[model samples]
Target: MATEPSPQRAYRAACPNCGAAVEFRSAASALAVCSYCRSTLLREGEALRRIGQSAELFEDHSPLQLGASGRWQGAAFTLVGRLQLRYAGGSWNEWHALFDTADATGAALRSGWLSEDNGGYVFSFEAPPPEALPPPEALRVGAAQVLGRETWSVASVTTAKLGAAEGELPFVPVLERAYVVAELRNAQDEVASIDYGPASEGRPPRWYVGRGLQLAALGLGGLREDSTRELKGRSVECPSCGAALAVQLATTQSIACHQCHAVVDVSKGVGADLQHYAQDTPGAEGRGGGEPLLPLGRSGALALGAGGTRSWQVVGYVERCTLPEPGDDEQSFWREYLLYNQKAGFAFLVDAEDGWSWVRPLTGAPQLGGSTARWQGDSYRELYRYTGQITYVLGEFYWRLERGQRTVNTDYQGPGGKRLNREQTGEGGDAEVTWSAGAALDADVLLKAFKLDAGQHAALQRDVKPLSSRGIGGLAGLFLFLLFVVIVFSLVRCGRDDCAELRSLYGEASNEYQQCARNTGGARGYGGSYGGFSTGGGGHK
Candidate 1:
């Protein structure tokens, strides 16, 4: 069986600033940061440093194991695996789970248990945008740079994770807990990462592991750390400030100095595709130092439909979305696609730059004036509610991210003869109604429809129960068949008439006579023969 990360060794580190005793977090890595001065201190690589006063401790209040249950938005949710990542002074952890929503008011959803961690948690979908997050603050800033473009009134979201760590970003613990110390390394194979938790002896950090990749750790009272493949090798060292920095391989084009925060355009600085460093250094540090390097790669995650239309959906860059509409001008900026599922009777419009656009009309209740509605907590009549039938299998959702733009053209039509179609040509945020469209509403209002109160979500699932067809008719038919079978068997007995009187004559031996009838064909008289319908016994006649 695969086990978690291995145990980590504790060490004391000098406060690079105050010279007061400090410590290392994990057993690996060369440098250690001073708790008092926060100065970046390097070790002689691959050697143990010193120790200091130990850190604090924290208690885990949750007993939730994998697959635990919880209640949210009036629905029950199943616990998925958790994501835990450690970086900087603290770490972040996130739980990936799924909830089954039966109705809009969220009353039909199940309530699963929840594990709350002060260490850190993902922002609730309902929480207001934070101060530093970029796209969410587009309202205040006239125009912002995102996905390689700048736009006014663009829709954007600040993601807390990058690369593989995107799934779970760990946050620092509010209360103290036991943590591990580790030695970090740079791309050029230098000993860089350092950790300090419980076991500090008042000195500097020294220890090295892994030529490439970053680290993943489980923090308890004691230290535990290990190497990981999640991190890309590209690391940064500031020439001006000498501060070490980690380069996020996913979206970073330039290296930002950790101390000075100077943005370094690596392409201009280095004339090569990747950078290199020496493997040897002094003072127990693994690799001494070398020129910083960064990779010129383009890799980004997919965001499904955030907005759409009657016959289609609008998706693409955050900047292309005009917050509320996709004006005809910005339509070309985002890549588009159309998707259809005949079994579920649904369609999707995917915009590469924005997100996904989904639609499913309800044929069950045919009425006058077919209109699009959204799914909200109280009613399915809201704007997020699509007029349609749906079956979400194995937690798969109606919305998903796609690679490029494609459209589905079908004979199925919507209100006023609108055919099933996906088009990229539309006006800002929501399309302007000038060409026979309508006003685009706010995303928050639509998102609110998804928010479920704990109890309401569970209630909606209870009302609908599964049923089998044919009802009592199936039972009655079975009983009558059995009765008919018994009558036919009795008529085929030995004596055609007055069989009961014959039974009285047989007295206590009647059962024996019946057995004889079954065993030896009963002389073809009072009882029937054993062989059925073959002999000319009265039973057969």
Candidate 2:
């Protein structure tokens, strides 16, 4: 005790596979994945033992690296390790960030995870260890689980594999090891995840809860430069129609033929066994042959509240239909044009038979309970819940898209007739939820914004009854009012001299006029012939 404990220091050893010097920053780290040779090395005393080769990390656009430092909640943290994980859809990075703060004993270290995917970044911290965790079987999707005092709904449950690892990690990661992760979401859009490593090892699962973070908040530096520029603006010929399509984004997986309306798979790059679906022939019943009102590649400026206006190009089009459920006989459908701006992401302009709507995807999850939901402080009531089918598709999509895709849709209406739509895909525990909010727009506004030919998009003109137009009833009332005014003016002018003049002109005929007035009554007194002229007269008072 008097001599004091030796300060823990970094040690270095030569990799057995590549003979390259590898440095381990933590004295407690027993294993390190060699960055030079990607060999799994076991640190035994002062020597390194090569175990196996690790898979090389897949290329991506992430701007992060080991040894990068950042501040979070006024605490300094360093990126010490990372685990690349791949799921059924794609791959993502789970960075192990070690905080500078030490515990009471100062012997243990604390760390968190920075999960980065193509969608965005999510920062999470380990929750207080629970006395016991529910079994994996009990974690059902959409079911509620209590953590501390907050209740979270299971959003997704997926099994992912460890693709690769780097830097000094607190625990050893076995290459190609499979782990179950159950993601939970709260009403506030807060996210939590439970990582269940092999339960046969008899270790308690880990729990983490946190919110999504923007890249600017991380203060990250020394990021790898993105190489997607080389892939952008690449052209690929459609396998079905042979029309050349310009791939706008490197991340695009599928595109539709502009000429033939065929869906083509381009994930393997252009000319590499591109798979395509033939255009669906119009059936004798006349199903699935609707044309888009807005042409693809048409760019329009959209006003985004305080963000001002930005131009978005129409990149994709989908015609979706909602048939009456079960016993119902009504069928409704709508057309949705997908717009994209490289900096602003995706948006939809929906053309329904009744009206048009401009919709944008929601980042914040809405609070849903029963048939009601609250979004951005506004409450919405459920309007319709139905299954939507993709009848036709054109242009490009970020993911693999196909014809006849179906999704369960629930729509809501809020203030000013604003719409909140929730579309769910997949089934059972693997369902994914997407929320979009929009408001009704006039067809004229859309036409002017896109600068489209009004004649060509005549179908987009909705049969909207003018709110101020009261039909023939208003015209009839106006005519009656004008006639009453004319009659009153004439009576006032004629009362002064009209009766006396009639008596002077028709002296002896005055008696005849009086007789005519008496015969015709006061309202229609003048209807007899006088001096070969038919004179119309009224009763004199």
Candidate 3:
């Protein structure tokens, strides 16, 4: 078992700009921001030099704070500093964690980073690249690259800016400066990122590798008390309508005004200029139904097998649709409710025309090849490929969202009711790929989980059942009836290729083909529906 090392003496200095005492816990930390004056200070030997002014962090009301302690891999660590960064979509935080462990020579303490984006978290440590890596502009989503001794798939390539800094940081942050970040993952559930600090600086890209972090298992302490209560108490006046809209989640970057139905941008915090945009209300023409079955703020407990059961509340809702294909005239729409748990982060509850499912963005990328995808030890077969677009949204979201935001989606069906969905957004080097995995949820199970009343359950239940559920007797009777009709049709000289056309058009596995076979006095079979919406962004990749 791993162990935490004994506490060592720390180097103390006075801030050059603020003339306040600043403490450095780790010998490796090169810079520190004065908590009193927000001065960016650089350490040279034993003296501190004022570099620049560190921007104040936007009020995110995050539960994790400086001095918070947690154990990872049996080693204890403390949250010492944070760096807040913003991209085109939204923002995220990388909290510096100074480990209470020593280096190989026992001369210095080690450190890692606790990344918090949207609601997801990952603790990573800096590592040396096996070889020279290409620039961020050369990495494309879904493409494979060799890193170190393993091959990894490019997950996301984002250009972000340093928005703020707080507490103490290992390096000085160029306030409001832009940089490129590229993320990659392997089949072994390892997530890695390459950070190229500001293009103008010409600094070598730094790499960090780690796995998904579960806060419940970390045994973290010293978190902010009543963080949710503080978030609930905060309200901001809508720029478009004068109505007060409450920002429910501490990580909320985008929220829709309840009164005017306009989406508000609070990425820079409510104190900054709040950007608002007009959008049509849900249930409007061509956008499908707007209201969600599980209303926002509704709490429920979900059992995710080995992941255990956790209570979640609906904090955000979105309506998405797949427009008609080249020759198809019908459109398929679905609803997704973003469920939030204080410790477990976020999960999506998707309600499609087929049925219901609960999915969460995966930190590790699954291996994809040809017509199959493999994750962990399970395998999934490709089901549907389509283009999905967000048509409407309600409540709060962690990323900047706009109407008609589109992505290319491919869904896969796995054994034991498991499902996998992959969504790719943006173009070329700017593209981002995200994967979500979950199992099908029965309406009755959800009805019980949410503790909904009879009326709500009745309205929510879907009539999607497999033909095998009808029992042996009912199947036998139906098969005999179909055979008799086929014989009668043959005797009447019905067109021989009448049913063949449908089989070719809709395919044998489709619901349309099964329905057509039943209606035309033929025998095929009906199966439960499969597939889900492709929701990308916000989640930590």
Candidate 4:
């Protein structure tokens, strides 16, 4: 078991602007915001100078706060300051964690950062930057960069602005200012972020390297109580239907109207006029069903090997289909359910015709080859490639999801029923790439996880076959036999009678007869085959 560290000596001073007591816990901190008057105070040796007034922090409903204590590795740390940053898509928080360590002089506080990404946490510490760091404009998405002995893939190049700041900071923050930030990742789940603020000021870029981590693993204490109480019960009226709808997650940007099935945009917050657009309900046009097997707000306990058993809830649902290829008559459809856990973050449960699988977005990029991929010492073979489009959506989502969102996907199969998938959105410099990894989940396990009744479990079950065990010849024969049976049934059922004239003209089981029967609406399940049986899009942010 881990524990927090003992209290350390701190420098106390009076705010020059407000005359309020100001404190700095870390010796390296040069700036402190006055809580009494929102004054930005800059420290010059023993003197304090009033720089400017700091902007008010946004209400992000974050669980962590100043003075929170936690353990990192074998060291104890305390949260001292925070910076709220915003990009075009959304906003996140960067907390300054001061670790208690011993120096030649005595006990000292070291500075690190804990960044909030999507719903997860990233523990990062400053690293020595390379001799020359490229500018944000020169760094392209999906491109590779080499640092020392490691090769990293560019994950994102965002133009982010400093929204607000609180508590003590190591460096003075330029409030409400825009700067370039580039993130890179490797195959080992390590992430590196380059801040160009220093470079813009005629200095080398500052690099911070770390990996995705769960909050529970940090052995944190003094977390905010009832962290989600205020946001969870918030409600707003639907603009389209005028029905009251509850907004569940604070990070949710879009939600669907259950009354009218209109996609409502809550990105501007529920306090503003909600924007909505009507879309056709999937399965209403006689296509595949769009109803989710798992109901929203339903909680389940999933046993994830070394991750242990954790409770997750179904927060969102989406229906997606592959675009019909040339000369193809029908499309393949699948549904994805968004599962959320406060501590574990987000994951997706895909329900395809073949079976169900659990997957989550990865923080690291995998090494891709011509037709193979390597990640975490495992290899994967290509299985399918297609373009998936969102057909329908319901419930809440973190991203600004819209109907007809498309992505080019490449899926791979690994050992022990594991799977890997890559989805690319946009093109060139504006492109964003995401990777997901998981394994095939059993239907019975889900049943147990959700504690479903027998009837519900039966409906959720899929007829998963061990197709790999069957030889290629056996699969071909089985396909031919099923085709023969469908043709025979179509011939007999055409025109509500045995079509003797057609049978004599094109033989008992000819292609021409089968085509005629299909054209006349006699052949069942003959429209088209589901191409490659894909996992629907959900995990990608």
Winning model by TM-score: 3
- How many steric overlaps does candidate 2 have? 2
Candidates' RMSD to native: 32.3, 23.2, 9.1, 8.3
> Number of the top candidate by lDDT?
3
For model 3, where is the 10-residue window of minimal lDDT? 521-530
Candidate 3, number of clashes: 0
Clashes of each: 124, 2, 0, 0
Ranking of models by TM-score: 3, 4, 2, 1
- For candidate 2, the TM-score is 0.70
Judged by lDDT against the true structure, how good is candidate 4?
A: 0.72
| Model 4 lDDT per residue over 107-185, tens place | 4567788987567778888877754777778888777788787888887776778878989998999976667778887
Over 455-485, each residue of candidate 3 has an lDDT whose tens digit, in order, gives: 8875565443432435547767677567645
lDDT for model 2: 0.63
> Please, what are the lDDT tens digits per residue for candidate 2 over residues 1-541?
0111134655788889988888775555677788898888888898988888778776444457787777777777778788888665445688887766653447654567888653346788877644466766787755567766766666567777788898777677876777777776666756777888865556778878777655556666555555356445478888776788877654456787777767887754555688888654231112223456678888988763323578888877765556457788444555677776644456677776557777765433577778898877899998777776665667776556555566777778889968877776666644555566778777787788889887855556543343234564777767756754453333211112233454467752466444433322211111110000000000000
- TM-score for all predictions? 0.17, 0.70, 0.84, 0.81
lDDT of 2 at 525: 10
Q: List the residue pairs that clash in candidate 4.
A: none
TM-score of 3: 0.84
Candidates 1 and 4 compared: the better one by lDDT is 4
Question: lDDT for model 1, on a 0 to 1 scale?
Answer: 0.25
